[model samples]
Target chain A: MLEDGNLVFAACIILMTAATYFTRAGGLFIISKITPPPRISAFLNHVPASILVAIIVPSLAGKGPAEFISAAITAAAAVFTRNLILSLLTGLICISTLRAFVF
Target chain B: MKTSTNKSPGTRVVFSGKGIAEGFLKCIPLGIGVFAYGIVFGVLAVQAGMTPLQAQIMSLTVFAGASQLMALELWADHLPVLALTATVFAVNLRHLLMGAAMRDWLVRLPPSKTYFSLFFLTDESWALSVREMASGRKDAGFFLGSGLCIYVFWNSATGLGATMSSLVDRYFRDPSVLGLDFAFTAVFLSLLIFFWKGKSQLPVWLIAGIVAWLFFLVLPGKWYIILGGLAGGIVGALRDA
Candidate 1:
């Protein structure tokens, strides 16, 4: 895998593609196959958001001032604007300016 | 007029051209935003060392913006196949709901069209198609049409961004100074906001974050996310029980 980059690259991409398609099709077909209990359903529902929280929290912790402050501001903007792009822009602008001059 | 109810076995759902046209037209504005966002991905893909052909193929096959961008963040000189695929699945798992939600509406269409439409499902297209279906528009082809609009714009913008990447590189040599380092972080933060259900889920999120942070400090790799996510869910289940 390390020696041959292209082959590994193509193989990885194919695997990713398959994984993505599985989620799309699985929900369509397999969802009707087995019924999950309500507790299981609650777990399933909460899992994705938890996963996102897992990804975001570690990312925010122990970061520099610029990145940290920018993230806070971005979260605020996201709550207000609810626009991903706008929130992203707010973070980028804040981080850029803060990194340049403040912190 | 169609209502937002499951079709009876005898009911016929027409995948009409008019539905497709309306879906496509209604999505044009959203598609424009997707195009611009695709450019950012394109530029980032190039920065991550993907050739234009490689990036385009990923875009063509995956056709998912958030997951694709997230994959690029995990890209490396030597591809960590497990990490990359796992991260992609974790991020894209939300699609399962979007897919199941469409079951009532799309199941009435022919299996071929129904399954094909799932290939193009994105957040924007899904939202538009669901709204239309709920608004008495039973045109199953609408989902396909809206997805196609986004597909075209996203691919075109990706190519353009790949070509223009050199210009961006020239202007912004240090990505950190330009705040590009925070791009993925910003995306994730906003996603967290969108996914925030309510104060009820706060305990779940808190446990997930604390567990994830612990593992991130003590261990390596992305497994922290899965472990933390599962732990949080289990906590939620226990809380409810």
Candidate 2:
């Protein structure tokens, strides 16, 4: 019942899903074969932090004052309270305030 | 480790109702940010020419934020399957390391439960699960539960965004109108702080940040994420050695 164009789109989605799944599950398959060395374990432990940094640094770099200030506020809130909700809310509120009124 | 060995076969299963509920509750705080991004993606997908159904199906099946966004940017009148596939693979390559990081915790369970639960793994849920593990809880249900909450929230928000694209367009005129655009970055920063250790992690974080920023400036796509992750990981390993 599907048209040719719709069928192509569907195929693309299916392929994309398969490729994404490979990345998600591939590590487990590889890790099963070898006992990860201590250094590797330590590296893996540090990976989450590194990945987080990787995701955020680009956004922080070469951005306007508004983004910088809001991110700084968000970081402070997170570090001081260690509450995810509070920090996110603080960032959202700060940015909105800055954009709406200040900037 | 003690828990794994001491438990009987029947009791070895990791899913628990209480743990699932706790995870769901713990994730509620971050759910808002996830929903916000989902709505944004939904609106963008509609604008990209996807029907509400196509956009919803993508969310249901893919469930990845950055890759989905990239896919929408690339979506056209004709499906450029090869380019889209490559872009998605490049964008999501970090998941390999994420899965590897959780290998010990995941390998304990049967393959069915392990893979099924992993299907829900995302940056947010994985970060939450890492926190849970740090706190000495090993319940796989926590991961699944967190994933379930975000999954439901994301899909529903996407549907809402797609169906109400016009309303979303008017309100979210600029995603930054209310700084909703910064929500994802804010959430990531908070999580980064949560996982920060003193001198030990500083070097690795710096290296990753620097490398990622450099790549972001120079590269055309999201290769920066993978590049930074690899560079930092290698440096961390060397430091440990």
Candidate number achieving the greatest DockQ relative to the actual structure: 2
Residue-pair clashes per candidate: 0, 0
Candidate 2 per-residue lDDT over residues B16-81, each given as its tens digit: 777778788888766767788889889999999999999999999988888999998889988899
Scored against the true structure, residue A45 in model 2 reaches a CA lDDT of: 74
- Cα miss at B120, model 2 (Å)? 1.3
* Model 1 chain B: worst 10 consecutive residues (lDDT sum): B1-10
TM-score (chain A only) for the predictions, listed in order: 0.68, 0.87
lDDT of 1 by residue, B43-133 (tens): 8999899998888988898888878888898898978998988877876775675566565467666667777878888766766675556
Q: Score the docking of each candidate (DockQ).
A: 0.45, 0.74
Winner by TM-score: 2
The lDDT per prediction is 0.76, 0.83
Q: Show where candidate 1 strays beyond 4 Å.
A: A1-16, A27-29, A77-89, B1-51, B63-154, B161-168, B172-184, B187-191, B194-198, B215-225
Model 2 spans with C-alpha error above 4 angstroms: B1-13
Tens-digit per-residue lDDT, A1-70, candidate 2: 3598888988898999988888888887788667888988878877777888998999778778889999
